[model samples]
Target chain A: MIERALKTGGVPIASMLKRGEVKILVVEDDKFLREILVGKLEKEGYTVFEASNWNVAQKHIQGDRPHVILLDIVLPGIDGFEVLSTLKRNRETSAIPIIIISNLGSREDVDRALRLGAKSFMIKAHHTPQEIVDAVKKTLEEYYLRR
Target chain B: MKLRVHGTLFAKFFWTLTALGTIPMAISTLFLYATYESRIRHIVDEDVARELQLNSGIQFLLIFLFVLIMATFAAYIISRNISRPLFVLTEVMKRIAGGNLNIQIRVRRQDEIGDLGNFVNEMVRRVKEARERQEEISAVKSEFISVAAHQLRTPLSIEKWAYNLLLDGDVGKVTPKQRELLEKAVMANESMIRLVHNLLDAARIEEGKFGYTFQKMDFVPFLKKLLQDRTVLLREKKINLVVQHPLPRDLFLTADEERLSIAIGNIVDNAIRYTASGGLVEISVDTAPPWVTVAVRDTGIGITKEDKDRLFTKFYRGSNVMHIATEGTGLGLFLAKNIVIAHGGEIWFRSRETEGTTFFIKLPLEFSPKSPSVVSHDSFVGSI
Candidate 1:
């Protein structure tokens, strides 16, 4: 149902390119958190796609690639680390800035996610939705400036 | 009266050698006398026999002396050989009993003493394994707490965002009365979030996973800013919070600012929590070369004698304050002590029941990160 919604609701690639609207993909397992994040990102005037797990996230990336990806560390089957490494290794998705929003606040977890090529790491409980939005904006600005 | 021999191995060996020598000497002397009297007396002249008897008597005396000397020498060597290793073993055992698990008994011999040394080594190895297993179990326990706390935090984060959106009028328009209630809910939710964070930190400290990123920072303004953040709490309790001036602005220290803030903030929070309305809580800093001490004094219900001993222990609450405030997790002082000690610092308190309590945190100006094993071990001792 989520994949079908993504297929139908997502703007066409040509229109998105023509409009130059920034697209954000949120990969989170929790439904309410995903909704709030998606809601916040949509409210911020960005086209947001929600993924409950890595498979759905992979479909979103392949179908209509997002400009930025908000990744969660813990997920069913393949974790965020796997998804991050795979994306970083791939030439196509390597440039897509991925910011990790996780419940795991350990130094090891943060360092690991960053080392695996996450643009930034945010602890879920420590940051509000607004702060996360700020981080996304900052990460995107840095990404564009570096380019 | 009975002669009570102290039954030492040395003494036993000496007596046994003496007995062995004396018994043979006594039998030889009796046999020589019998033979000289029965056979030699009938065949030899009186003078010659008498001279022979005297010569034999001297020979026996010389033999007895030689045997006694040999026995004493042999017994001394044997006893020394046995007692020396035993002495070394006793000392090593004492050190092992004193919680030094890394020492090993070196054994070169293939005898009973060597067997004993090997046994001690095996025992120590097993003890070290058991201690490691215990540590692993503790790490697992900390991991459990960490994972559980993270799980709790996810929903709490969702709740926090939901509340934030509601308060920010993102969902809909909120009334003034509704905003006030929502703010209270936010505070309560934040406290719950803080509690989860504390549990995570405590677990990390236990598992020696608490990361420290130390940098040179000014101590005075850092403290002033921290106190400024707590002014609201001080105002709410109507407690007079004071920071003694003339605190050197150049009092620099190498510290993890985020962690040190939490440690100091916990101390200040505890002072605010326990202090009654219209009470005084004073914070002061004193620098003496390499050492900088921060003293937080509160004029509130002081620690009882029973609670003083375990004040820095994990999950410990004072007898007097438990009824007064039930919101404490009893982890603040425990965490404060661990963080302070991790920075090569010390934390101690002086309190008198029903009067007040003053906590002193003494930190080094230069933080030389001790090995994690040593830091965790020290914090473990502090927690216990």
Candidate 2:
């Protein structure tokens, strides 16, 4: 279920792309998971940006901002929900789809993140980095059609 | 009327009692019709001739008898008037007792009794409204808790896994105290997670907002399959589970597998916990008429008679069981009983003080699965 939801939600369309390039951002607190996500995301033929916490995530959003964020619900300072909510609220980052990649897989949790405008929610243990990339790619593809 | 002999709520032949009792009165009235003015004078003759004639008292007795009958009829009408609203109020009380907080005692009359009924109705309404609000807040609180729990889980998992990764020398070796601290942290995090899950589950169940999908599955094979799945854990405990399956290999019955899993899981786990080393846990099936029974008998620290009475009660930690096990929250049996009752089933048990105990669950083969009735629990959500 997690993999499927992620696969459907992963894709991020870099707005300034030459109708080809896809840019993805991976935001997490743990250095290990961050490394794992970036390695696989980079291998998937897209530029990937990494942030250890919400501060760095904000920096990435402001400068060298990617099209979509693979945001973990847990971060060092401000959490991922706040970041996702801020992104959705801000006109500049609002269009960039947010996928909540976290281990919190409870139905209520999923419902909450989705209600907070998260494109989708996925539990980490069930998904590989490739699936997240696929999720981003798929989400971007779907959003491009809407655009 | 005549006193009722049985358990019936309403009585028949009430009108006949009135008619039977009215017969002589009717005859006397007929007699008076034949001699109208003279009979009227004779009936009240004692009132006209009191202390002057003793026989005149007989006519007076008749007049008084007529008035007594009239008063009895009038009393009936009055009692009926009082009973209608009283019945309505009783029905409202029944609804409240049955957990239907939304029912109101609608009394429009301004009499003292009516006012009392109206007051009670309004009180119930306010209570229902307030309870609905409390329920709403609890739901929102559950939602927030669920969300917060999920959000917090990611970091906690990362922290725990990272600590595990650290302690296991995936990254580097750690000191014994450091490892111990991480272990404590992991344990605490686990407890917190469980607490959140239980609290949310309880709130959802209470609010009647939870969804369940039921299907038919066999009992013995189901346990067998679950045992196979938990073989590793069972092996660690070194305790054997003997299931005497006289039931059909594919005994079809209607239920929600997951909920039943949780229910039976609690029983099995309780047995596993309570049974000392080398002790056996016996799970058996009894297919009797009117019910099917699944029993778990364990050679555990047997429960006291007091413990037996409140075993399935929420937050009740048995004295002996508590001494043996401290890690449990005492909510599993509570949840199990709740789910079982909801499934139109009965869960009960028998216990011996120091020998052994057996818990039994008898579920209907088929039942009218309780459709979630419109309740304060529903409006509880709506208001929020």
Candidate 3:
């Protein structure tokens, strides 16, 4: 039934990506993690691109308009907080939902990210790669349906 | 008949001095009274009036001396009893202040001072009990860490080997269903390994009694194995490493193989963390006669001067590193320092903010069989 609804147009269940493509950008400094996120999201049929730092993420956004971003709080140069804020401030990327996937999930960080237009914030230890993919898909679909 | 200290020679002497001063005046008054009475009797009437006046003067002197003696004895007894116990109590207070709460002051009387001593004893008992409770709480926390470390690794061991088995596809090519589950398991297991590592470190640090087994090992083959084993893990970041040589083909170093590997591994892991994708983490080895050293340099965000000083201390996270990443238990560097020190080596780092960081470890080339085992002894004392 979920597959049927998703294949039709869009599912109200906010889980339409199980059988569909949902483009995603994974911004993280941890290479090991970037590979896993890219692999898992790609397997789940989401178009996935990688960025090791804020500079590459900015570059990626200029070309491809991803539906959702998996942002790591700690990055190479500019941290994820700055990246999230910049993305939210831009008109073109403002509607593009973000989910902070990071080792920093302190209440203050989560609250800050949420205020900066992140759809959700998740701690890496608290969620698996697959869960992150699931969350991104759900949040994107929810944002779409709400809009 | 009782040999009384209260009415002893000193008390009598003090009283005599008082008596001597007052009695002379009393005698003169009496003499004047007698003369006045005799003159009055001669001038006007009576033997009776003179006799009565004389009797009153004698009685007054006798009563005054008696009261003076009694009061002097009472004052002596009062000062002795009150001051002696109070002085002893103050001395006991000093000892208690010096952390010797073990002394018991014997208060023979059931007076206020005895009650005070008992109250002090109760206070000491309570303080000692509170200290014991704190020690017990700390012990429980350490025990929990150790127990949790051991327990966590068991599940990890099971899941790790199980995933390996499943990924090997002995049960046949995995369906998407099976793949998804195994992927989650793998992810969770990795996190679990990190948690266990942190818990073990915390427990060991708290216990100050880390169990370590030392054995002489070859450095060359160990380094080779490390480089080979971590290639895939490092490939995730696409980071490259350059190994520079001043090392022999197969250098023999007398040290605990496991501990040395862990220490080097921590440094390598930290380098990997700091080096961005496409950045370099360089490993170089050099010798200074009796010493051999390994240096790891990363092109990641570096440490400030103040941060560099406190880098290897327990729970110390550098400002630059902290901004880049979180979830560090901050025990790896501390453990690495301990391991290196145990091998009679020195560990230090050089870093500049935004430039990058380089950590160097120096170990003695020759290990004396009599390496004192000083660390273990110190650890034992600390545990106590």
Q: Say which prediction, candidate 1 or candidate 3, comes out ahead on lDDT.
A: 1
Q: Compared with the true structure, what per-residue lDDT tens digits does model 2 show for residues A1-147?
A: 222334565433353233325567888877877876676566556678898878777888898767778998867666667777888889988878899988755556677789889998877644545566678878866665443
Ranking by DockQ: 1, 2, 3
Distance (Å) between predicted and true CA of B137, model 3? Answer: 4.0
True contacts kept of each: 0.77, 0.15, 0.00
Model 1 lDDT at residue B200: 92
Two-way DockQ contest, 1 vs 3, winner: 1
DockQ of each: 0.54, 0.14, 0.02
- CA shift of B272, model 1, Å: 2.1
Model 2, B1-384: lDDT tens per residue? Answer: 896424322222234444555666667655654554455547666455443333434564676577557655665666567666666677667767888776555456777887787677688788878987997987787677556755665565556555545555545678888889878876676665565555555656755655566787776677677667656656767788887855556566788787788788888888887888788889887877557788999888888877777887767889887757667877788888988988889998887876778999898887668666655542221100
User: TM per model?
Assistant: 0.74, 0.62, 0.43
TM-score of chain A of each: 0.84, 0.81, 0.83
- What would the C-alpha RMSD of candidate 3 be, to one decimal place? 22.9
Candidate 3, residues B146-203: lDDT per residue as tens digits? 7766555544544554575467574469989989999887867876778676666656
* Chain B TM-score, all predictions listed: 0.73, 0.70, 0.56
Residues B35-86 of candidate 1: C-alpha lDDT, one tens digit per residue: 8888998899988888888888898888888878887789878988988788
What are the lDDT scores of the predictions, listed in order? 0.85, 0.70, 0.73
Error of 3 at B269 (Å): 1.6
